[model samples]
Target: MKHLSDNEKDTSRIAAALAEDLQPGNVLLLHGTLGMGKTVFARALIRALTGRPDIDVPSPTFTLVQTYDGLICPIYHYDLYRIEHPEEIFELGWDDALADGITIVEWPDRLGSYKPRLSLDITLSNADNDPNKREILIETNA
Candidate 1:
Protein backbone atom coordinates (compact mmCIF):
# COMPACT_ATOMS: atom_id res chain seq x y z
CA MET A 1 0.00 0.00 0.00
CA LYS A 2 1.06 3.59 -0.66
CA HIS A 3 0.32 6.51 1.59
CA LEU A 4 0.97 10.22 1.48
CA SER A 5 1.50 11.70 4.90
CA ASP A 6 0.93 15.44 4.99
CA ASN A 7 2.64 15.78 8.31
CA GLU A 8 4.17 13.91 11.19
CA LYS A 9 0.77 13.32 12.75
CA ASP A 10 -0.41 11.63 9.60
CA THR A 11 2.67 9.44 9.55
CA SER A 12 2.09 8.41 13.12
CA ARG A 13 -1.52 7.59 12.36
CA ILE A 14 -0.46 5.35 9.52
CA ALA A 15 2.03 3.57 11.74
CA ALA A 16 -0.55 3.09 14.46
CA ALA A 17 -2.94 1.52 12.00
CA LEU A 18 -0.27 -0.87 10.81
CA ALA A 19 0.62 -1.76 14.39
CA GLU A 20 -2.80 -3.30 14.89
CA ASP A 21 -2.04 -6.08 12.44
CA LEU A 22 1.34 -7.06 13.83
CA GLN A 23 2.04 -10.37 15.53
CA PRO A 24 4.92 -12.18 17.19
CA GLY A 25 7.63 -13.37 14.80
CA ASN A 26 6.76 -10.53 12.47
CA VAL A 27 9.64 -8.53 11.00
CA LEU A 28 9.32 -4.97 9.77
CA LEU A 29 12.12 -3.66 7.56
CA LEU A 30 12.13 0.12 7.55
CA HIS A 31 13.89 1.61 4.55
CA GLY A 32 14.74 5.28 4.27
CA THR A 33 17.57 7.74 4.10
CA LEU A 34 18.67 10.05 6.85
CA GLY A 35 15.92 12.25 8.29
CA MET A 36 13.26 10.42 6.32
CA GLY A 37 10.98 9.87 9.33
CA LYS A 38 11.83 6.19 9.78
CA THR A 39 12.32 6.75 13.48
CA VAL A 40 9.11 8.73 13.71
CA PHE A 41 7.07 5.91 12.29
CA ALA A 42 8.90 3.41 14.45
CA ARG A 43 8.30 5.39 17.60
CA ALA A 44 4.61 5.68 16.86
CA LEU A 45 4.28 2.00 16.06
CA ILE A 46 6.06 1.05 19.27
CA ARG A 47 3.82 3.33 21.28
CA ALA A 48 0.69 1.90 19.72
CA LEU A 49 1.75 -1.68 20.39
CA THR A 50 2.70 -0.93 23.98
CA GLY A 51 -0.49 1.03 24.63
CA ARG A 52 1.68 3.92 25.68
CA PRO A 53 1.06 6.81 23.36
CA ASP A 54 3.53 8.94 25.26
CA ILE A 55 6.20 6.30 25.67
CA ASP A 56 9.77 7.24 25.00
CA VAL A 57 10.84 5.18 22.03
CA PRO A 58 14.36 6.22 21.33
CA SER A 59 16.14 5.27 18.13
CA PRO A 60 18.47 2.34 18.69
CA THR A 61 21.32 3.99 16.85
CA PHE A 62 24.08 3.66 19.40
CA THR A 63 22.68 0.73 21.31
CA LEU A 64 21.94 -1.31 18.18
CA VAL A 65 18.73 -2.67 19.62
CA GLN A 66 15.97 -1.76 22.06
CA THR A 67 13.34 -4.10 23.48
CA TYR A 68 9.85 -3.18 24.58
CA ASP A 69 7.08 -5.18 26.20
CA GLY A 70 4.12 -4.81 23.88
CA LEU A 71 0.49 -5.39 24.81
CA ILE A 72 0.52 -8.77 23.11
CA CYS A 73 4.21 -9.70 22.94
CA PRO A 74 7.75 -8.40 22.96
CA ILE A 75 9.00 -5.82 20.49
CA TYR A 76 12.58 -5.60 19.30
CA HIS A 77 13.72 -2.43 17.58
CA TYR A 78 17.07 -2.59 15.80
CA ASP A 79 19.32 0.00 14.19
CA LEU A 80 22.02 -1.70 12.15
CA TYR A 81 23.54 1.39 10.59
CA ARG A 82 26.71 1.28 12.68
CA ILE A 83 27.29 -2.45 12.49
CA GLU A 84 30.52 -3.55 10.87
CA HIS A 85 29.05 -6.73 9.52
CA PRO A 86 25.74 -8.53 9.27
CA GLU A 87 27.15 -11.48 11.23
CA GLU A 88 27.38 -9.15 14.23
CA ILE A 89 23.59 -9.14 14.43
CA PHE A 90 23.70 -12.60 15.97
CA GLU A 91 25.37 -11.12 19.03
CA LEU A 92 22.44 -8.70 19.36
CA GLY A 93 19.86 -11.50 19.73
CA TRP A 94 18.56 -11.23 16.20
CA ASP A 95 17.56 -14.87 16.13
CA ASP A 96 15.74 -14.68 19.43
CA ALA A 97 13.82 -11.57 18.36
CA LEU A 98 12.70 -13.22 15.15
CA ALA A 99 11.63 -16.33 16.98
CA ASP A 100 9.41 -14.76 19.64
CA GLY A 101 8.96 -11.03 19.16
CA ILE A 102 8.04 -8.38 16.68
CA THR A 103 11.23 -6.95 15.13
CA ILE A 104 11.53 -3.49 13.61
CA VAL A 105 14.77 -2.87 11.76
CA GLU A 106 16.07 0.47 10.58
CA TRP A 107 18.76 0.39 7.91
CA PRO A 108 17.83 -3.18 7.11
CA ASP A 109 20.08 -3.04 4.05
CA ARG A 110 22.94 -3.42 6.46
CA LEU A 111 21.62 -6.87 7.30
CA GLY A 112 22.86 -8.08 3.91
CA SER A 113 22.43 -11.83 3.71
CA TYR A 114 21.07 -11.92 7.23
CA LYS A 115 17.93 -10.07 6.16
CA PRO A 116 14.80 -12.14 6.59
CA ARG A 117 13.07 -13.36 3.46
CA LEU A 118 9.62 -12.74 4.88
CA SER A 119 8.97 -9.24 6.21
CA LEU A 120 6.95 -6.10 5.88
CA ASP A 121 9.03 -3.54 4.01
CA ILE A 122 8.23 0.11 4.71
CA THR A 123 9.96 2.73 2.59
CA LEU A 124 9.78 6.42 3.41
CA SER A 125 10.82 9.38 1.33
CA ASN A 126 10.31 13.13 1.10
CA ALA A 127 7.25 14.14 -0.79
CA ASP A 128 7.59 16.88 -3.38
CA ASN A 129 10.46 18.46 -1.54
CA ASP A 130 8.17 19.20 1.37
CA PRO A 131 9.99 18.77 4.65
CA ASN A 132 6.79 17.94 6.50
CA LYS A 133 5.35 15.64 3.87
CA ARG A 134 6.33 12.00 3.39
CA GLU A 135 5.68 9.31 0.84
CA ILE A 136 5.38 5.90 2.38
CA LEU A 137 5.16 2.58 0.67
CA ILE A 138 4.40 -0.66 2.46
CA GLU A 139 5.03 -4.01 0.89
CA THR A 140 4.82 -7.53 2.26
CA ASN A 141 6.90 -10.50 1.26
CA ALA A 142 5.37 -13.02 3.58
Candidate 2:
Protein backbone atom coordinates (compact mmCIF):
# COMPACT_ATOMS: atom_id res chain seq x y z
CA MET A 1 0.00 0.00 0.00
CA LYS A 2 1.05 3.54 -0.76
CA HIS A 3 -0.03 6.44 1.41
CA LEU A 4 0.43 10.17 1.19
CA SER A 5 0.61 11.94 4.51
CA ASP A 6 -0.02 15.66 4.24
CA ASN A 7 0.61 15.95 7.95
CA GLU A 8 1.26 13.93 11.08
CA LYS A 9 -2.46 13.30 11.60
CA ASP A 10 -2.76 11.53 8.28
CA THR A 11 0.32 9.47 9.05
CA SER A 12 -1.06 8.43 12.38
CA ARG A 13 -4.37 7.53 10.80
CA ILE A 14 -2.58 5.27 8.36
CA ALA A 15 -0.62 3.68 11.19
CA ALA A 16 -3.81 2.96 13.12
CA ALA A 17 -5.36 1.31 10.09
CA LEU A 18 -2.33 -0.88 9.58
CA ALA A 19 -2.12 -1.77 13.25
CA GLU A 20 -5.52 -3.45 13.14
CA ASP A 21 -4.28 -6.44 11.15
CA LEU A 22 -1.04 -7.26 12.97
CA GLN A 23 -0.45 -10.82 14.15
CA PRO A 24 1.93 -12.38 16.67
CA GLY A 25 4.75 -13.12 14.27
CA ASN A 26 4.47 -9.96 12.28
CA VAL A 27 7.77 -8.17 11.74
CA LEU A 28 7.71 -4.66 10.40
CA LEU A 29 10.90 -3.27 8.85
CA LEU A 30 10.77 0.52 8.92
CA HIS A 31 13.06 2.32 6.51
CA GLY A 32 13.51 6.07 6.35
CA THR A 33 16.18 8.71 6.71
CA LEU A 34 16.51 11.15 9.57
CA GLY A 35 13.53 13.46 10.15
CA MET A 36 11.18 11.19 8.22
CA GLY A 37 7.99 9.98 9.90
CA LYS A 38 9.19 6.47 10.81
CA THR A 39 8.99 6.86 14.56
CA VAL A 40 5.74 8.81 14.31
CA PHE A 41 4.05 5.96 12.47
CA ALA A 42 5.46 3.34 14.84
CA ARG A 43 4.25 5.29 17.85
CA ALA A 44 0.75 5.50 16.41
CA LEU A 45 0.63 1.80 15.68
CA ILE A 46 1.81 0.97 19.18
CA ARG A 47 -0.79 3.26 20.69
CA ALA A 48 -3.53 1.71 18.58
CA LEU A 49 -2.51 -1.78 19.56
CA THR A 50 -2.47 -0.88 23.23
CA GLY A 51 -5.96 0.62 22.76
CA ARG A 52 -4.66 3.61 24.66
CA PRO A 53 -4.81 6.75 22.65
CA ASP A 54 -3.01 8.63 25.41
CA ILE A 55 -0.29 6.13 26.05
CA ASP A 56 3.28 7.33 26.20
CA VAL A 57 5.13 5.78 23.27
CA PRO A 58 8.74 6.81 23.52
CA SER A 59 11.28 6.35 20.79
CA PRO A 60 13.53 3.35 21.37
CA THR A 61 16.57 5.25 20.23
CA PHE A 62 18.90 5.13 23.20
CA THR A 63 17.35 2.09 24.83
CA LEU A 64 17.45 0.14 21.56
CA VAL A 65 14.21 -1.71 22.27
CA GLN A 66 10.98 -1.36 24.16
CA THR A 67 8.10 -3.76 24.79
CA TYR A 68 4.44 -3.20 25.50
CA ASP A 69 2.11 -5.77 26.97
CA GLY A 70 -1.69 -6.07 27.49
CA LEU A 71 -2.32 -5.48 23.84
CA ILE A 72 -3.94 -7.91 21.35
CA CYS A 73 -0.36 -9.20 21.14
CA PRO A 74 2.86 -7.98 22.65
CA ILE A 75 4.80 -5.39 20.64
CA TYR A 76 8.61 -5.19 20.56
CA HIS A 77 9.81 -1.91 19.16
CA TYR A 78 13.47 -1.88 18.14
CA ASP A 79 15.71 0.96 17.10
CA LEU A 80 18.78 -0.64 15.55
CA TYR A 81 20.49 2.63 14.82
CA ARG A 82 23.08 2.21 17.54
CA ILE A 83 23.81 -1.39 16.76
CA GLU A 84 27.22 -1.86 15.24
CA HIS A 85 26.60 -5.55 14.55
CA PRO A 86 23.57 -7.74 13.99
CA GLU A 87 24.75 -9.99 16.81
CA GLU A 88 24.12 -7.04 19.09
CA ILE A 89 20.43 -7.85 18.83
CA PHE A 90 21.04 -11.22 20.43
CA GLU A 91 22.56 -9.47 23.41
CA LEU A 92 19.32 -7.55 23.76
CA GLY A 93 17.33 -10.81 24.04
CA TRP A 94 15.94 -10.35 20.57
CA ASP A 95 15.04 -14.02 20.25
CA ASP A 96 12.60 -13.69 23.09
CA ALA A 97 10.67 -10.97 21.29
CA LEU A 98 10.95 -12.61 17.87
CA ALA A 99 9.44 -15.78 19.28
CA ASP A 100 6.59 -14.27 21.22
CA GLY A 101 5.78 -10.78 19.96
CA ILE A 102 5.28 -8.61 16.95
CA THR A 103 8.52 -6.78 16.19
CA ILE A 104 8.94 -3.36 14.60
CA VAL A 105 12.50 -2.51 13.59
CA GLU A 106 13.98 0.83 12.63
CA TRP A 107 17.27 1.04 10.67
CA PRO A 108 16.80 -2.58 9.68
CA ASP A 109 19.67 -2.36 7.23
CA ARG A 110 21.83 -3.00 10.23
CA LEU A 111 20.46 -6.51 10.34
CA GLY A 112 22.67 -7.42 7.42
CA SER A 113 22.06 -11.03 6.26
CA TYR A 114 19.77 -11.83 9.15
CA LYS A 115 16.43 -11.31 7.52
CA PRO A 116 13.10 -12.49 8.81
CA ARG A 117 11.14 -15.15 6.97
CA LEU A 118 8.37 -12.72 6.18
CA SER A 119 7.86 -9.12 7.02
CA LEU A 120 6.11 -5.92 6.17
CA ASP A 121 8.61 -3.36 4.86
CA ILE A 122 7.56 0.25 5.28
CA THR A 123 9.51 3.11 3.81
CA LEU A 124 9.03 6.83 4.31
CA SER A 125 10.31 9.68 2.16
CA ASN A 126 9.76 13.40 1.93
CA ALA A 127 7.20 14.40 -0.68
CA ASP A 128 8.42 16.72 -3.39
CA ASN A 129 8.43 20.42 -2.44
CA ASP A 130 7.11 19.85 1.07
CA PRO A 131 9.47 18.84 3.85
CA ASN A 132 6.66 18.03 6.24
CA LYS A 133 4.69 16.01 3.70
CA ARG A 134 5.77 12.40 3.23
CA GLU A 135 5.20 9.47 0.95
CA ILE A 136 4.96 6.11 2.70
CA LEU A 137 4.96 2.70 1.13
CA ILE A 138 4.15 -0.61 2.78
CA GLU A 139 4.87 -3.94 1.15
CA THR A 140 5.03 -7.54 2.30
CA ASN A 141 7.63 -10.02 1.21
CA ALA A 142 7.14 -13.76 1.40
Candidate 3:
Protein backbone atom coordinates (compact mmCIF):
# COMPACT_ATOMS: atom_id res chain seq x y z
CA MET A 1 0.00 0.00 0.00
CA LYS A 2 1.08 3.57 -0.54
CA HIS A 3 -0.01 6.83 0.95
CA LEU A 4 0.97 10.48 1.01
CA SER A 5 0.69 12.15 4.38
CA ASP A 6 0.39 15.90 4.41
CA ASN A 7 1.39 16.32 8.02
CA GLU A 8 1.86 14.56 11.33
CA LYS A 9 -1.88 14.33 11.91
CA ASP A 10 -2.31 12.71 8.53
CA THR A 11 0.43 10.26 9.33
CA SER A 12 -1.19 9.38 12.66
CA ARG A 13 -4.51 8.89 10.96
CA ILE A 14 -2.99 6.47 8.53
CA ALA A 15 -1.30 4.51 11.32
CA ALA A 16 -4.51 4.33 13.32
CA ALA A 17 -6.31 2.90 10.35
CA LEU A 18 -3.65 0.27 9.90
CA ALA A 19 -3.66 -0.52 13.61
CA GLU A 20 -7.24 -1.75 13.37
CA ASP A 21 -6.07 -4.87 11.54
CA LEU A 22 -3.13 -5.70 13.82
CA GLN A 23 -3.08 -8.87 15.89
CA PRO A 24 -0.87 -10.64 18.31
CA GLY A 25 2.38 -12.00 16.82
CA ASN A 26 2.28 -9.29 14.20
CA VAL A 27 5.59 -7.60 13.54
CA LEU A 28 5.84 -4.14 12.00
CA LEU A 29 9.19 -2.91 10.77
CA LEU A 30 9.34 0.84 10.30
CA HIS A 31 11.96 2.21 7.93
CA GLY A 32 12.80 5.88 7.71
CA THR A 33 15.56 8.36 8.13
CA LEU A 34 16.02 10.55 11.16
CA GLY A 35 13.31 13.25 11.48
CA MET A 36 10.93 11.12 9.50
CA GLY A 37 7.52 10.20 10.92
CA LYS A 38 8.36 6.67 12.07
CA THR A 39 7.83 7.45 15.72
CA VAL A 40 4.68 9.38 14.97
CA PHE A 41 3.24 6.39 13.19
CA ALA A 42 4.36 4.06 15.96
CA ARG A 43 2.86 6.18 18.69
CA ALA A 44 -0.40 6.39 16.81
CA LEU A 45 -0.49 2.65 16.30
CA ILE A 46 0.21 1.99 19.97
CA ARG A 47 -2.50 4.34 21.05
CA ALA A 48 -4.96 2.74 18.69
CA LEU A 49 -4.09 -0.75 19.85
CA THR A 50 -4.50 0.18 23.51
CA GLY A 51 -7.79 1.94 22.74
CA ARG A 52 -6.38 4.99 24.45
CA PRO A 53 -6.12 7.92 22.14
CA ASP A 54 -4.42 10.06 24.77
CA ILE A 55 -2.00 7.53 26.14
CA ASP A 56 1.65 8.42 26.36
CA VAL A 57 3.71 6.60 23.76
CA PRO A 58 7.23 7.75 24.20
CA SER A 59 10.05 6.78 21.85
CA PRO A 60 12.14 3.87 23.18
CA THR A 61 15.38 5.32 21.88
CA PHE A 62 17.25 4.99 25.18
CA THR A 63 15.38 2.07 26.67
CA LEU A 64 15.60 0.11 23.39
CA VAL A 65 12.14 -1.32 24.00
CA GLN A 66 8.87 -0.46 25.64
CA THR A 67 5.86 -2.57 26.51
CA TYR A 68 2.21 -1.73 26.59
CA ASP A 69 -0.99 -3.62 27.28
CA GLY A 70 -3.15 -3.64 24.20
CA LEU A 71 -6.83 -4.43 23.89
CA ILE A 72 -6.08 -7.53 21.86
CA CYS A 73 -2.72 -8.43 23.39
CA PRO A 74 0.54 -6.99 24.66
CA ILE A 75 2.38 -4.46 22.50
CA TYR A 76 6.16 -4.42 22.20
CA HIS A 77 7.75 -1.29 20.75
CA TYR A 78 11.43 -1.64 19.94
CA ASP A 79 13.96 0.95 18.92
CA LEU A 80 17.07 -0.81 17.69
CA TYR A 81 18.98 2.40 17.11
CA ARG A 82 20.98 2.06 20.31
CA ILE A 83 21.75 -1.61 19.77
CA GLU A 84 25.37 -2.28 18.86
CA HIS A 85 24.58 -5.69 17.45
CA PRO A 86 21.51 -7.63 16.40
CA GLU A 87 22.29 -10.33 18.96
CA GLU A 88 21.74 -7.71 21.62
CA ILE A 89 18.02 -8.01 20.96
CA PHE A 90 17.96 -11.34 22.79
CA GLU A 91 18.77 -9.54 26.02
CA LEU A 92 15.85 -7.20 25.43
CA GLY A 93 12.96 -9.71 25.33
CA TRP A 94 12.99 -10.16 21.56
CA ASP A 95 11.96 -13.80 21.83
CA ASP A 96 9.18 -13.15 24.29
CA ALA A 97 7.82 -10.34 22.18
CA LEU A 98 7.77 -12.52 19.10
CA ALA A 99 6.05 -15.36 20.93
CA ASP A 100 2.92 -13.34 21.59
CA GLY A 101 2.75 -9.63 21.07
CA ILE A 102 2.35 -6.94 18.47
CA THR A 103 5.90 -5.77 17.85
CA ILE A 104 6.69 -2.42 16.28
CA VAL A 105 10.34 -1.91 15.49
CA GLU A 106 12.08 1.28 14.44
CA TRP A 107 15.50 1.30 12.73
CA PRO A 108 14.88 -2.33 11.95
CA ASP A 109 17.98 -2.41 9.72
CA ARG A 110 19.89 -2.51 12.96
CA LEU A 111 18.47 -5.97 13.48
CA GLY A 112 20.79 -7.24 10.75
CA SER A 113 19.87 -10.86 10.03
CA TYR A 114 17.58 -11.14 13.02
CA LYS A 115 14.64 -9.61 11.19
CA PRO A 116 11.55 -11.80 11.09
CA ARG A 117 10.47 -13.22 7.78
CA LEU A 118 6.75 -12.88 8.30
CA SER A 119 6.29 -9.24 9.03
CA LEU A 120 4.96 -5.95 7.75
CA ASP A 121 7.32 -3.29 6.50
CA ILE A 122 6.49 0.40 6.51
CA THR A 123 8.77 2.93 4.94
CA LEU A 124 8.37 6.66 5.30
CA SER A 125 10.29 9.23 3.33
CA ASN A 126 10.09 12.89 2.48
CA ALA A 127 8.01 13.42 -0.60
CA ASP A 128 9.67 15.61 -3.24
CA ASN A 129 11.91 17.25 -0.68
CA ASP A 130 8.89 18.55 1.18
CA PRO A 131 9.51 17.88 4.84
CA ASN A 132 5.85 18.20 5.70
CA LYS A 133 4.82 15.68 3.09
CA ARG A 134 5.71 12.03 3.56
CA GLU A 135 5.45 9.14 1.20
CA ILE A 136 4.60 5.95 3.04
CA LEU A 137 4.94 2.53 1.57
CA ILE A 138 3.70 -0.60 3.31
CA GLU A 139 4.45 -4.16 2.35
CA THR A 140 3.99 -7.52 4.02
CA ASN A 141 5.92 -10.75 3.77
CA ALA A 142 3.11 -12.81 5.15
Candidate 4:
Protein backbone atom coordinates (compact mmCIF):
# COMPACT_ATOMS: atom_id res chain seq x y z
CA MET A 1 0.00 0.00 0.00
CA LYS A 2 1.03 3.58 -0.60
CA HIS A 3 0.60 6.51 1.74
CA LEU A 4 1.40 10.18 1.47
CA SER A 5 1.97 12.33 4.51
CA ASP A 6 1.90 16.08 4.57
CA ASN A 7 3.79 16.47 7.83
CA GLU A 8 5.28 14.62 10.78
CA LYS A 9 1.91 14.25 12.48
CA ASP A 10 0.42 12.69 9.40
CA THR A 11 3.33 10.34 9.20
CA SER A 12 2.85 9.34 12.81
CA ARG A 13 -0.82 8.68 12.22
CA ILE A 14 -0.04 6.49 9.27
CA ALA A 15 2.49 4.58 11.37
CA ALA A 16 -0.02 4.15 14.16
CA ALA A 17 -2.52 2.69 11.74
CA LEU A 18 0.10 0.28 10.54
CA ALA A 19 1.09 -0.58 14.09
CA GLU A 20 -2.35 -2.00 14.76
CA ASP A 21 -1.69 -4.71 12.24
CA LEU A 22 1.67 -5.84 13.64
CA GLN A 23 2.14 -8.94 15.77
CA PRO A 24 4.84 -10.30 18.02
CA GLY A 25 7.89 -11.79 16.27
CA ASN A 26 7.20 -9.65 13.24
CA VAL A 27 10.02 -7.91 11.41
CA LEU A 28 9.57 -4.50 9.82
CA LEU A 29 12.26 -3.54 7.37
CA LEU A 30 12.45 0.18 6.70
CA HIS A 31 14.40 1.57 3.80
CA GLY A 32 14.87 5.26 3.17
CA THR A 33 17.44 7.98 2.80
CA LEU A 34 18.80 10.08 5.61
CA GLY A 35 16.25 12.47 7.13
CA MET A 36 13.48 10.64 5.32
CA GLY A 37 11.47 10.28 8.57
CA LYS A 38 12.04 6.55 9.07
CA THR A 39 12.88 7.05 12.73
CA VAL A 40 9.97 9.41 13.19
CA PHE A 41 7.56 6.82 11.89
CA ALA A 42 9.18 4.22 14.11
CA ARG A 43 8.80 6.31 17.25
CA ALA A 44 5.15 6.83 16.43
CA LEU A 45 4.58 3.14 15.93
CA ILE A 46 6.34 2.32 19.19
CA ARG A 47 4.19 4.77 21.03
CA ALA A 48 1.08 3.36 19.45
CA LEU A 49 2.10 -0.16 20.36
CA THR A 50 2.75 0.72 23.97
CA GLY A 51 -0.18 3.13 24.22
CA ARG A 52 2.18 5.65 25.76
CA PRO A 53 2.22 9.05 24.16
CA ASP A 54 4.97 10.28 26.44
CA ILE A 55 7.37 7.48 25.69
CA ASP A 56 10.57 8.61 24.11
CA VAL A 57 11.88 6.44 21.30
CA PRO A 58 15.46 7.35 20.63
CA SER A 59 17.16 6.66 17.34
CA PRO A 60 19.45 3.65 17.72
CA THR A 61 22.05 4.98 15.33
CA PHE A 62 24.97 4.74 17.70
CA THR A 63 23.76 2.09 20.09
CA LEU A 64 22.77 -0.31 17.30
CA VAL A 65 19.74 -1.46 19.22
CA GLN A 66 17.37 -0.08 21.80
CA THR A 67 14.80 -2.02 23.75
CA TYR A 68 11.48 -0.69 24.99
CA ASP A 69 9.86 -2.42 27.94
CA GLY A 70 6.40 -1.03 28.49
CA LEU A 71 4.76 -2.52 25.44
CA ILE A 72 2.64 -5.66 25.60
CA CYS A 73 5.50 -7.41 23.80
CA PRO A 74 9.13 -6.34 23.78
CA ILE A 75 10.13 -3.99 20.98
CA TYR A 76 13.62 -4.07 19.56
CA HIS A 77 14.65 -1.08 17.46
CA TYR A 78 17.83 -1.56 15.47
CA ASP A 79 19.87 0.88 13.39
CA LEU A 80 22.48 -0.84 11.27
CA TYR A 81 23.75 2.27 9.52
CA ARG A 82 26.99 2.24 11.49
CA ILE A 83 27.64 -1.45 11.21
CA GLU A 84 30.70 -2.29 9.16
CA HIS A 85 30.02 -5.99 8.87
CA PRO A 86 27.09 -8.38 9.12
CA GLU A 87 28.94 -10.36 11.77
CA GLU A 88 28.59 -7.34 14.04
CA ILE A 89 24.84 -7.91 14.09
CA PHE A 90 25.30 -11.38 15.49
CA GLU A 91 27.35 -9.82 18.26
CA LEU A 92 24.47 -7.45 18.89
CA GLY A 93 22.08 -10.39 19.32
CA TRP A 94 20.04 -10.18 16.12
CA ASP A 95 18.73 -13.71 16.14
CA ASP A 96 17.75 -13.50 19.79
CA ALA A 97 15.80 -10.29 19.21
CA LEU A 98 13.98 -11.82 16.27
CA ALA A 99 12.97 -14.72 18.44
CA ASP A 100 11.74 -12.31 21.08
CA GLY A 101 9.20 -9.72 19.95
CA ILE A 102 8.77 -7.05 17.29
CA THR A 103 11.88 -5.86 15.51
CA ILE A 104 12.05 -2.62 13.56
CA VAL A 105 15.23 -2.26 11.58
CA GLU A 106 16.58 0.75 9.72
CA TRP A 107 19.23 0.54 7.03
CA PRO A 108 18.66 -3.18 6.81
CA ASP A 109 20.74 -3.16 3.62
CA ARG A 110 23.71 -3.10 5.93
CA LEU A 111 22.90 -6.68 6.81
CA GLY A 112 24.38 -7.66 3.48
CA SER A 113 23.70 -11.35 2.78
CA TYR A 114 21.77 -11.92 5.97
CA LYS A 115 18.28 -11.18 4.86
CA PRO A 116 15.48 -12.48 7.05
CA ARG A 117 11.95 -12.79 5.80
CA LEU A 118 10.11 -9.68 6.86
CA SER A 119 6.48 -9.27 7.65
CA LEU A 120 6.50 -5.82 6.11
CA ASP A 121 8.71 -3.57 4.02
CA ILE A 122 8.33 0.18 4.26
CA THR A 123 10.08 2.42 1.79
CA LEU A 124 10.03 6.20 2.04
CA SER A 125 10.92 8.73 -0.61
CA ASN A 126 11.03 12.47 -0.89
CA ALA A 127 7.96 14.10 -2.37
CA ASP A 128 8.54 16.19 -5.47
CA ASN A 129 6.30 19.07 -4.47
CA ASP A 130 7.13 19.53 -0.80
CA PRO A 131 10.19 18.93 1.33
CA ASN A 132 8.15 17.92 4.34
CA LYS A 133 5.94 15.63 2.34
CA ARG A 134 6.99 11.97 2.18
CA GLU A 135 5.76 9.20 -0.08
CA ILE A 136 5.65 5.93 1.83
CA LEU A 137 5.11 2.48 0.40
CA ILE A 138 4.26 -0.42 2.68
CA GLU A 139 4.18 -4.03 1.53
CA THR A 140 3.52 -7.24 3.42
CA ASN A 141 5.21 -10.45 2.33
CA ALA A 142 2.71 -12.57 4.21
Highest lDDT model number:
1
The TM-score measured for candidate 1 stands at 0.98
lDDT of 2 at 53: 93
Clashes of each: 0, 0, 0, 0
Query: What tens-digit string does per-residue lDDT give for candidate 2 at 86-120?
Result: 99998876788778788999999998888686899
Instruction: Give me the overall lDDT of model 4.
Output: 0.88
- Model 1: runs farther than 4 Å from truth? none
- RMSD for all candidates, in order, please: 0.6, 1.0, 0.6, 1.1
lDDT (Cα, tens digit) per residue for candidate 1, span 57-81: 9989999999999999899999999
Candidate 4 TM-score to native: 0.95
User: 32, model 3: CA deviation in Å?
Assistant: 0.6
Better of 1 and 4 by TM-score: 1
Q: How accurate locally is residue 102 in candidate 1, as Cα lDDT from 0 to 100?
A: 97
Error of 4 at 67 (Å): 0.4
lDDT-best of 2 and 3:
3
Q: How close is candidate 2 to the true structure, as a TM-score?
A: 0.96
The lDDT per prediction is 0.96, 0.89, 0.95, 0.88
